[model samples]
Target: MSLRIRNLQSFLRPINRRFPQAVWSSRVVTSIRYNSSTPNNNSSRRPNSGEEGSNKKDTKDSDLPATNDEHNELLEKYNPDKSSRVGTPKGAIPAIDHDLASLLKKPKYEYNPENNTNEVTYEFPPPKSPKQLKVEKIREKSKPKSRFKKIAPSLIAAGLASWGIFTYSYLTSKTDPDKDGETGLLRPDKFLPYVISFKHQIDDDHYLIELTRKNRHKKLINNETLFNGKTMWSIEIKQPDINIVRNYTPLPLYVAGTDPVTKEPHLRLVSESEEQGKFIIIVKKYKQGEFSRWITGLNLLHPVEVRGPIVEHKFPGHPLDKFYIKRPQLANLLSKIKPDPEYPEKLPKPENYVYYGAGTGILPLLQLIYSPNPPKGFIEAYLSIHSESNLLDQFKTLNYFAEKIGRVKFHYFIGEKGEHLSSKDILKPTLPNFTGLSDIKLSEEQYREKLLAEKREEVKRQIANGGISNEGKKSITHEEEENHTIPKLDVSKFKPDNAFQQFNIFKKRKTTPDPSFAFVCGPEGYMADVSGKSDLNNLEMVDNGPIGGKLKEKGWTLQNIKRLQ
Candidate 1:
């Protein structure tokens, strides 16, 4: 048998040598076929009958060798399985055993449904002992700090350097004469130029101009006591070819008004600054006035020179105090007439102040009236204007003050003939041309009679309107009657002659025992006509005028009258 096998091998060796690669490939194919065809009892059962049978046969054939011992040994020497098989199936991935996979997996705590509760329990770390805390603090201190903490000193030094530079620049620039030279009547060292920060139109010809100081001079303008007392500041403006200067009394920087939503009185918001301060000035443009034209034509950031808290007037204890020495004639007259018992030490502030103003001349008076703490008295202001629309536009601000004080009386005199009937008309006879020439002015008696007649007509009208009971002779209650009555003082169209009549009525009205004063501000002729020689019945007059010659002619001494222009 061995000799026969050797002869067969000798015959095959020549064929193997001639086709070495073919022989190796055939051996690999035979091995695969034998492994696929063999069956084994230990093979796993499959669901598909045909596939299960094939897999069983493949398992059984894998145990049997296809060639003799010599061939088997040679094949084993060149077997691809030794390097590549790795115990895996052909084209099939090796799977981990169930027990081995479980050992390799991360351990997990099984969830218990019974332990799932809505209440949450937190595991807090145990508190450290005092000694441990102290040790930790010491360790933290010894450790290196953050980058920001390390460079904090450098940052502070840089900040201080910047502040010093700014201070030096500010002091030098503000004081430098070449940089801020004197303009007009304003001295650069004292009054400086303020740039126009904002402009708001209050009316057709009225504007509220806000002026701000330059950055370098901000500290100078931030003076708390800059605008104090009843004084005015002068503004210097230069036109292309004209030099014009005007004096203005600035309005209060802040005012008190009722909040629209809350109906509570609050300090109305005002535009102001701290380091860079600003002030507002109200200007009224005039048709032919050069100063007004120049002011109105200014643009935003326009520089304006401003100076002073110019003293307009100073009040003495009495009207005759300043004149007592000047006029010797007053000494004898004053000795005979005992000083007023109510005002023995000093002339008391008027219990009732009747103010008369025309157009923009009313500004200073308005400022005084709306002062934070004005004189304790009632105010009756009569303003004469060219149009009623002008007063209507300012009604909100005026009404706010009126409502705040609750004692303010505002009477507007609109200058239009057809819209208003003159008080003098009441004295005229029914006939167009009377036989006897009568005085156009009405006597005091006639004026009182006319008022009585008007009151009777008003009562008759009320009776017709069911405000009074005809049969019972019973009228409406006082409160109900007041509701129907017109406002005592309100905007009204008036003839030029009506101003004198209104002044007379205001003077006649009864007031507290304290003395009263009448202030009149307007055109030369208007001031004269209102404050002219007339029996005021203990009412003193202060004329605000550009020219006091007319008042002086009327026996009004300089001491008795205060003028602002």
Candidate 2:
């Protein structure tokens, strides 16, 4: 019902206690008129009580049974506090009639961080600023005396062992009290180091030694410098005692005999008996060879250290199976040939002869050719005579021998034109029968021909192989200037008269000298020639310099011993 209508009805019906019935009715009528005048929809479109319409329906059921007593008891027990409503949930705001279910529910209180509901959300007051941890130093405690006592024996033993080792070393290496600083064979007072000995003379601006390192001894046993101190000879048969020579430089110097057991360095002597023994060492004064100079300074009859006779040259077969060519062959050859009656008889004969010696290359060759101990057959004699002056005497000597034997042949290439025979002159016998280099003569054409002929065959072959020739091909691919040049005959193409053929026709020819048996002692070119020729026999010729040296392009070794040093 409307508020005004309800108020008016209540006023008209109940008025016994307060009097003024007219006044109350008049007030109610007035309020009713005012409410009727106002618009109803504006204030009461819906009832404030949610059960307003539903209450009318429940009134009919209430007449059947009154549950007020049980309901009152529930109210008394659940709602002891009058301010709270127990029948309906207390403090529940009425839900709005809308589509949103969450909005219809009670609004939750926004959380304050200080009063968080989650128990884990509590943060322990930020860790109190941590204190720095400090490292503590430890104090050492003294060990008991018993521990040191136990280890004392071990320490003493160690010290004794170390001392013993030191003492042994000192004793082994200690010098003799009588001859301080002396070890090997000689005493300190007369200690003689291994040195080269030479006799000198002045020629032009150079100082030349007539001989070099004639004597070298292993031990001081029976040492003697014979032939007015020009020759030295010593005997060392005790192999096991002197292992230094062979162990140090195992190979033979000239042949073998460097090794004590091998006895290869020992050579055969002219004497019919085999007891004779000697050693010959040929050393050249190189541009700068310290060993050569040292050898020249040694004194006669004085001790000179002798190393192995490493045999550089070999026989027909195995090279390692060598003997000393110097002591026997070289010595024997020298005794027979050397005009000096003073020459020793103990020396051995030179198996093969070699010249081209700066100073001594000619020594062995001379001895072999002229000596009674000459090789059983023909021998190769090469000489390295640099200057015309040195050649004069040598040439005369060589000529005499060549004519005397008529079996010996020579090959000589001169680097310089003057005072030396050209290759052609030597190859072809000319007027005066020019015995040596001084007799040869040549013209400009001949010189040019000689120069052009060198390596001509190789050049032609290279061209034929589509290397340099302008042949039929349209294109010309020349890698070098030499490729463009034409080939001509040179010394390489020159074939000497076949001495073997002559031997076969005239004298009974033995087997051709095995090229391997060639004895080469000269400049590098001479040695190379021998080596190359010896290739036919598979000879293992010894050469010091590596292939393709500075003169590699010229196809020659600058170290060639055209003339002796």
Candidate 3:
């Protein structure tokens, strides 16, 4: 058996060489010895059993202990425990032991067999230090806050409040329709205070008052100069705990003369009683007008608040150009026509004007007539008064001054005391330039026959023109129908009578046709009658209130007729 064991050792020598660093222990060698000592059970299969036993013996021998030196060498070569050494190859990732990782993840438990209980325990991470906690807080605080989150609410609230305030103010504000929606609040800074320096009673109801402003306040009126009959100032008075305002065109208190230093003509304010800083206003008292009554009762040095040089009419250069050219449809038509050489490009000064005034209405007309360097025009004025004494002397004085600059003709309709002359009778014959009642009567009969003949000719022309067969002709006829359809005033209502006849006579008398502007300021009825019947086809009309409505109805454009009031 010893020999057999030696042979088996020899045969395993080659196998051991293949695994030179295989680990071995004393228990493994003992197991190999026991396996070699065991007997085979099979007798008939002796050879097969012997061979199998031998292979088992060899395998057991391979695990047997070698010499001490060889064992120590094997321990060094292939270590089972390498706790103190780096287990990874150089520049290579270390292999992870999943078993160790699972052991660490499992909870450790202490078994108490006596009580049949298990006490579970786990290790927790260490608590943070104060310094580490502070650092973490700082990192959190360093993050930027959202701007929308901080300010969005405040912005939304302010926007809503602003919109509400604007909406309320717009709804409550007072506006003027005639002034293209201008607010009623005039600039308070422009108001000037004056004192009534003098007052003279010209008649029972007519008074001439003089106002004076301090020399320091002269700058207030510096830019207050305006074109005659185009602008006026408002006088506001406070008395009897009531406010009254009236508008008046200030008269020239002084003659305009050339400035010696600048060579520019300067208007020197005239003071009738040698008073400095004086201006005059001719006011006619009315029975029911609070402002007029207050003015009549005003004592010397009474305080008055004045505002504006409010412009009623703005003079657009070249009247016909502005008047006709502003209408786009009309302008397009006019563009097709060749420009006329005789048509004046501009009238440096007006050529002709007709003025009609009664009582207080004459003040504006008088201002225009007496203006220094007045516009070059044939001015015809018709003045109607309660009595000859009321404005006869004033008229004479006006005529004397007016003749110096231009031709002026004045017709006075003076009535007996308590006998009020009808405005129609006063304005009718004068506007037509009839010298007496006989001329007016004769012209009326001829004017009726002439109007009838013109109507018949107009109908005949319409029929001859094929009525409305042509499309272009149809359009023209439609427009003509529209124009002719305008409501005409009753002949009795206007009493046109001889007005057109007088207009023809005036036109024939003039050497050449001149551009004209007509001004009528009197009773509403009188202005309506004169404006409706007057045949100054080339003239423009200006008045106050709706007195020009009749003219507007008779195909006169609102642009050609301005209502100041």
RMSD of each: 25.3, 26.2, 21.0
Each model's number of backbone clashes?
Answer: 7, 55, 2
lDDT of 2 by residue, 1-565 (tens): 3455446445443332233322334333433443454355643655448766674455344422125653452333333445532232223223423643444355668866667656564556444333421211112224345877889999999999999987876786565452223333222223223322233322432333221222223232344222111111121111223332211111011222333773222233223222212333333445574544444444554335443222332222211112322211223222233211111212222122223332334443443443332333344344446554443343345445442333345544333433332222211111221123332233334556766786797678667766753564434456754478776645434333332222333344353231112233444555444332222233554344443322233233323312221
Q: Tens digits of per-residue lDDT for model 3 on 1-565? A: 5455445445444434444432232223333444445455542344576588886677576555445754554455444555423232223222335874565467758864445446343365457899999999999899887999679899999999999987875665545222112222223335455668667676788877766653424333334332232332333334435754567756655324444784422334332223233456778888997778877898988877665555545533333333332211101121221221122322222346556666666666666644433433456667667776566354465465443222456666766645433443222111222234465456567777878889999878877766655554643557667767657555433322232222232222344223244565665555565453233334354332333433444334333443323
Clashing pairs in 3: 253-270, 254-270
Q: Residue 259, candidate 1: how far off, in angstroms?
A: 16
Model 2 regions more than 4 Å off: 1-198, 202-283, 286-288, 297-302, 317-374, 380-382, 388-403, 410-519, 524-565
lDDT (tens digit, per residue) of candidate 1 on 1-565: 3344346455445445544543443344345444445344443444487677876676565545545875575565454654433332355222435864554465657876447786365366457899999999999999999999999999999999999988887789777864653322233235566677667666688776766655435354434433322333334434435655567765444323445884433322222233224445777788998887787778998877666545454322322232232111101111221111121212222244456677766766665643332433455666777775454333346444442323356666678632322232111111111111131122334666877999999889877766756585656667778778576674235422321233333333354231144455666556655454322344344432332333334344433344345
TM-score of 3: 0.38
lDDT (C-alpha) at residue 542 in model 3: 35
My TM-score estimates for the predictions, one after another, are: 0.42, 0.28, 0.38
TM-score of 2: 0.28
Identify the runs in model 3 with alpha carbons over 4 angstroms from their true place. Answer: 1-190, 216-240, 254-277, 319-349, 392-395, 417-515, 528-559, 562-565
